[model samples]
Target: MSLFTNSNVTCPNCEAVVNMPAVGSVNADRRPDFRDAILDDSFQVTTCPNCHEAFRLAPLFNYLDVGHGQWLAGLPASRVVDWPEVEDDIDSVFQASFGANVPAAARDVADLLTVRVCFGWPAIREKIYLKGVGLDDVTVEMMKMDLMRRLKDAPFVQGTELRVGAVDDQAFQMVWIDAETEDVRQRFSAQRALYDAITAKPEAWAALRDKLSDGPFVDMQKLFLGQGRVAAE
Candidate 1:
């Protein structure tokens, strides 16, 4: 049951033979090794020796529900109680969702993936460090619905998802939020243009762009929520 003890599993990047060390037998606490977290001070990191690929490992394996049907164990963000870089268990959501190339595209701005907004930097720092709202997952219409949902008891935004962008987390942050003004929408759309240019499939790009252009610069949150599930959010 050890995470690092996969007797038959080899390093995906280096093809080096490896084995997962079993943590404990049945009915054990099943806690992960905190060595990496101590080193990370509570964050996780992974690097591929063969490719120099680096990524946060917490989000990737944190979603795994492999222990005794205890789905609740992995629910809250607080469950990430350790920090360790296991190249064997590197975050693969990006690779599986948007393909492996996204790591290169995102490496430059990884720390700034999500930023907390505030009147000042210190306030922003405190809210993010303690409160932990996802900086990269913020969206216009999504923000509106979320605000109205908690503050006003309002309904969710219902519309076609227009343009989507990877502001941070690998989740889709919609653009239909009410607070998004024209300028914000335009900037969001402009970012989409970058993805279109990088795609290997030019035809898909044209088709996507044409479909995206159909409306008069509409909110993309409605158009792209589920469709761009594969796009790095």
Candidate 2:
């Protein structure tokens, strides 16, 4: 079920309190629109009426994607009222919605189910964006590691950030932005040909299926690297 609650938010600029709608809870089956909003990267924005300022609102909510059989409980550090009972609460909510047949991805809530802890709006946005692009979060992290390795020899400024951008049939675009100015520094494309070729193998596909069944995020760096690599073998 989709749930929303109004909360009084004090404007950082004017200190004027305004009641705003915050997502109290949500599930994909019950509220696919909320999932759509996140996929569109539109859920992080909230505007203050009095100050007329737009700011990011991080609310505690359960993100359940039935289509993907994925469930995420997002808890930003700033809003934690009770830390002790979080596990029990999350289990209760999950059981209430999904009953006993929980997905293997979240079978062990303490270890694998919890995705974000003390994460900001951007973190949430990145997860949704990557998922939308049919990529695993851990795979993206490994990709980022590879990107950093490639960039180690390149000439760049001090506060530059590299992130995975648009994914296309041809390539995956990696965007480099200036951290201080938040300006696009460069856009580099990494050809998807190699990835496509590797995953085309039966072993690779089976490994991926097993990983996804285990959890939404999977570190496939080892699977694709070394003499013992799945692709090479």
Candidate 3:
């Protein structure tokens, strides 16, 4: 079930206090509109009644979409630096709910779900968008790595991310966005063949796949971040 709680929020524009309903967990299978809101980049947007300014809350919720076989923990981008600890925490939560610690029936459900952790809106939105388009996300991350090598002025930096904005038969529309402000700094498209070529040669990317999939936060950015959690042998 989807859960929301009314909380006090300070309007960043005017410093006015506003009471709003903040989401705790979203069950996209039951309320697909929530999923649409996320994809359209409108979820958790609130207008300050005092200053009439629009602001979006940082995502800090669990998202479940059984139909799409996804389960994600959407966290604030500021927490990216602490991803290793956060990953372990979310993993334990998943285990308690649907993994080995749970009943056999729940564990069966877990087998069909792809568990992930995403920082900020763009990261989570890109994940859902990729799933909708039937794209392999791990491959897409590998493609980004290749793009960084080819693009002379790629803006691959801290607090900036390369995310999939849209896709078509021929190409993938990509954007470089500020993780905190959700501002798009640049946009470009990569040939669909880039994704296909990588998918065709999985053995070549086997080591990379292992690193990206080592935790629920299966993003290539982790490679650039501080030393990530070491996987159990």
Cα displacement (angstroms), candidate 2, residue 32, comes to: 2.6
Candidate number achieving the greatest lDDT relative to the actual structure: 3
Clashing pairs in 2: none
Query: Any idea what lDDT model 3 has?
Result: 0.91
Candidate 1 vs candidate 2: which has greater TM-score? 2
lDDT of 2 at 32: 73
Report the alpha-carbon TM-score of model 2 versus the true structure. 0.60
Number of the top-ranking candidate, with TM-score as the measure = 3
Error of 1 at 112 (Å): 37
Model 2 / residue 110 / CA error / Å = 14
C-alpha RMSD values across all candidates: 19.6, 8.8, 1.4
Lowest lDDT 10-mer window, candidate 3?
223-232
Query: Arrange candidates by lDDT, highest first: which order?
Result: 3, 2, 1
Stretches of candidate 1 exceeding 4 Å from the true structure? 5-44, 50-53, 57-233
Span of ten consecutive residues with least summed lDDT in model 1: 68-77
Q: Estimate each model's TM-score.
A: 0.20, 0.60, 0.96
Q: Sort all candidates by TM-score, best to worst.
A: 3, 2, 1
Q: State how far residue 107 of model 1 sits from its true place (Å).
A: 44
For model 3, how does the per-residue alpha-carbon lDDT over 1-233 read when each residue is reduced to its tens digit? 99999989999899999999999999999999999999999999999999999998889899999899999999999999899999999999888899766789888889989899999999999999898888878889999998888887877678999999999999999999999899998999999899889999999999999989888998988897987766669
lDDT (Cα, 0-100) at 147 in candidate 1 = 36
| Local accuracy by lDDT, each model | 0.29, 0.56, 0.91
